[model samples]
Target: MVCAVIINAENKRIKLCNEIIGLMYGYIQWNSYDTEAGGIILGRENLGNDNLIFEFITKPMKKDIRTKNRFLRKDSEHIEFYKQLYSKHNGVYAYYGEWHTHPEDIPHYSIIDLTNWRKISKEDPKEMQYHIIVGRKQLRIWEMRKKCFMPKLVCEVKWDEINI
Candidate 1:
């Protein structure tokens, strides 16, 4: 059964996101919640088939407040930063959702994770958002549907495809 949102990304983008997430794990371990990185997932959406092709990603703003294993908070400044980036790109990119890292070798979503995704879905009922949790060696994806998050498959990736 499908348990996470299907993510279709280029190999380089996936590699980059994974690398950044891995760095977060190291930072959390070395410095304790002082650093975390995340940003919008940019891609094409085939609404008719419920498929998404994520082509690019953004970096989280420096102002975000991250915890040991959670993206605890994001201030308005960070939101504005994303908005500006999206706007400047001439609508090519959108607020697809979020991606963050965890410290565990196999991390699972927490209550806070569900709550945040639910909140975003509720606030933006018309659009479907996604959330990705990158663990040391595991990647989990969730799609917001009808005010909730659902797991889906990682359908495809680019060159030298690495099936997570």
Candidate 2:
């Protein structure tokens, strides 16, 4: 399993499991025809610490909107999956944030991405959320606090580093 850890400037850490990372890697925009794909991030917080361990993520469903440059998660299955995990795990598992693909060598959050993330931060029950953008060669993660106006860049993981 591809185990990876990312620590932000604020000393907050996030662990990405192999399965979820692998699934995300599959949706990287590799070709011209490739479109964006995205889903929600679900995981648990480490007790007595600010660290997080991401264990699950929903995959793109038929109801989702996909385009070469945009991805809108319109599927109800993602929420259903999150509900199931939260229920099965008895609240240990929770929503972390959103993830999507960007057809670039190095990804940066677009205006739309920022707007949507801010909306999520305000609406999601969790006080902290993490958003990930998978690029052609790397993945960038951002951390957003519900009370904060802007999300901070947590860390960036390169595709080569994962060796997938």
Candidate 3:
């Protein structure tokens, strides 16, 4: 289990649980032919403090489209998983954002990522959404608000930092 706390510009802490980190690390694109993998992020809000705790994430399903450089989630399983968690937790566990792997040492969001994030932000009921990109050597996290047009880089955690 490897956990990390990311402090945003506003001094708010976004905590990533060990299980969530481990699951994403398992899908990192390590080999040349490895394709992208992705799923939805789910977590609970720290009421009163406004901090976020990311404790769960869905795994890529069989219905997802995958290529060496692209990943398209076409699986309804992801949504089904979310619904189950939401119900099990009585709405405490909510959608945080999306996560995907990038075959690079340090990943940057592509144009498609930006556009998709924007659309999700506009449509999601949550006021804030957080996304993550798992790279070969790092994990980059971004935060997007419903009223914001672009997602802002919140934090980057190197593999070494997690000591995984």
29-109 per-residue lDDT for model 1 (tens digits)? 333444445565655544455445554555555667665655654556646655776688666445677777666555566
Per-residue accuracy of model 2 over 1-164 as CA lDDT, tens digit each: 56655554466667888888899998999999999999999888888987788888899999999999999899999999888888888889888899999999899999999999999888988787889999988899998998899888878898887658
In model 3, the Cα lDDT at residue 33 comes to 97
In model 1, the number of clashes is 5
- The most accurate candidate by TM-score is 3
Selected candidate, larger lDDT, 2 vs 3: 3
- The lDDT values for all models are 0.54, 0.87, 0.89
Order of the predicted models by lDDT, top scorer first? 3, 2, 1
User: What lDDT is obtained when candidate 1 is compared to the true structure?
Assistant: 0.54
Q: Return the lDDT, model 2, position 155.
A: 84
TM-score, predicted candidate 3 vs. hidden true structure: 0.94
Question: Residue-pair clashes per candidate, as listed?
Answer: 5, 0, 0
Q: Which has the better TM-score: candidate 1, or candidate 3?
A: 3
In Å, residue 154's CA in model 3 sits off its true spot by: 0.5
Considering only N, C-alpha and C atoms within 3 Å, which residue pairs clash in candidate 2? none
lDDT of 3 at 29: 98
